[model samples]
Target: MAGSLLVSLSGITARTLDGCLDLATALDERGVPLSLLVTPNAEEGHRSVSDWVRERVVQGDAVLLHGYDRRVRDEFADLPAHEARLRLIAATAALEDTGLRTNAFAAPGRRVSAGTLKALRLHGFAVYSDGSTVRDLRGDRLLRARLHGFGGRGGAGETARRNAFVLAAARLVRRGELLRIGLRGADLDRPGRWSALLDAVDTALECGVVAATYVGPAPRVTCSPRGSTLTSVPSGARLVNRP
Candidate 1:
């Protein structure tokens, strides 16, 4: 099988979730698969939003429970260490209620600490997505991520650079190693420059790179409810599942 392209959405704000939902609908219409990464904090007063997302999860769309909180040390620093642990447990429990459990874990920025990793394993997470790779402590499920550049005004230039980096990184991972690369277009909150983003995706695909886009902290394991399949996002790209 060719590689897969995984699109992720992280830190989906309350104000933007609705717009994202609309975007998802649009992408669904286009047949583009996507994964959503929702933070615990973002879902605070937005239980309805979660409900809506769950209701919309289709065969192409997959939901993964992200970190317990937003990973903000300042806000959660006051809580006792033990209490913090309990909070993460509670968050995972809440996600389980939503019927998404397999690939649930934290997306602590780009890196994860030993404690965090341990906690995730303790909490029943099978896979954890970070900047490096998809790690599975038990089985031999170690897969490294291939990240592309961000998308914006100078997106093409940045994407070129990112592609170069991915190529170099791929060489190091092992010849023909399956890679998961990141790709972005105009900021979803801002006016999206679809043409430019598509250009980036095309470039990456041409170079034999599997492209992916992230929304929240964790990686999306499946496609989004939106028309993720409609886009010509190469068959090799794997969309990582996010919250």
Candidate 2:
């Protein structure tokens, strides 16, 4: 089967409401399937973004757990499994309080560990994805997350990181591999950038690659011996870790 276009938008703090929505609206209008990997609440922004997220879900978008407040991004690795599970449960419950329910999750800033993986499987999560793989972790199957938004507007390291990912992502698609691309609501500030990304996605779709949420089993993957690098991940993979 052809791979999918697993588009996910991250960093959904209140300030990014319009930019994020603009990007999401563009994708939705194109009939692209999406996963709104959103932070449950923002400490500073309006609640409209969260409400909009809920509406998107009702309109057929998938919601994945991002984080609690997003301030604790770097600490995901240090969180004990019990605490991790509790946090996720709390976050999901909070979403439900807003009338949205989900069994999917993505990490915030740290690398998701074996402990986090186990916690996700036990806490009603059936699918998990990170910078390395979009996995049916419950079944030991690999999934694809091809493209992700990269580059911080001002940081050199962030720019380098995004560039590196762009190179890698391009290689995968060129090889006829299927993967998910990560999108960010913040990037919508420069509409041209997002427009270009959508055009690239359209190019991939015209090549006969599937352009929707990925569903089903994938290749077996193992933890990279060091760092978050996953060896042998398929081209159609999507997602990322925290820290």
Candidate 3:
């Protein structure tokens, strides 16, 4: 088996501090280092969330950023576009306020345009992760990631199937080169869902990929109903301080 990898969680919405904290704490306890991506508007609504994250979560442990406040429609909405861009700038500013700088960016819903890419580059972000792929914005590397399951509108069996397929792909990829696995509970809620997601991570690890989860901008101490503990994830799998 190859060396382990990291996981990242993205698109953390506003006012989800408890969820963020709970997940982060749980993953941390388990020895899994989770990277959080946050939107500027979310910080605006829940300013304390960012404060708690900065105070409790160590630097180089989180990826803070802007997320779309609303869903991207077929017909682009000017206000949403402006807000999204502004959110990116605001997120960068917020991190700077804490004396932290994040180089990774994730767009909500993985719906990114040329304008969004330009904004990210201007802000000094080098990487972007989405449901469909992981992009090396500064380079030419692009990795396709298969979505395993969604917690919001899917059945357990379906999720399992999707996870299995993704794991298979991960296994194949691991054989070719060192790989990074990205995990997110975007549609799932609670620690149990996160724990279940770890199963996928474990699978990737066995196949020689580094697994990481995206935690978004939520705080790092909130408890989940499933008794999930972020601190319990295995530390060897974490990827820290990569540009």
Which predicted model would earn the best TM-score?
Answer: 2
> Candidate 2: worst 10 consecutive residues by lDDT?
233-242
lDDT (10s digit) by residue, model 2, range 104-127 = 677776468677787887886777
**lDDT, model 3, position 49:** 55
Q: Pick the candidate with the highest lDDT.
A: 2
- Superposed by TM-score, candidate 2 places the C-alpha of residue 98 at a distance from the truth, in angstroms, of 1.7
RMSD score of candidate 1 (Å): 9.4
Model 3, span 1-243: residue lDDT tens: 343344555545454556666767665655566666555443454557556545544633655454535444421123344545676776566555544456776656536766676666665666776655555566534545433433354555765655664665465445533233444435345444565566655555555444444333221221223222222121111123324
Report the number of backbone clashes for model 1: 51
Each model's total of backbone clashes = 51, 25, 45
TM-score of 2: 0.76
lDDT of 1 by residue, 119-230 (tens): 6556555556665565654453555544443533554465555455455543522332333433322255443333333444344344454433322222223322321222
Off by over 4 Å in 2: 42-46, 144-147, 154-171, 214-243
The segments of candidate 3 whose C-alpha lies over 4 angstroms from its true place after superposition are 1-4, 11-16, 42-45, 56-60, 68-87, 94-100, 147-151, 155-192, 206-243
RMSD of every candidate to native, in Å, equals 9.4, 6.9, 10.2
Return the TM-score for each candidate structure. 0.60, 0.76, 0.61
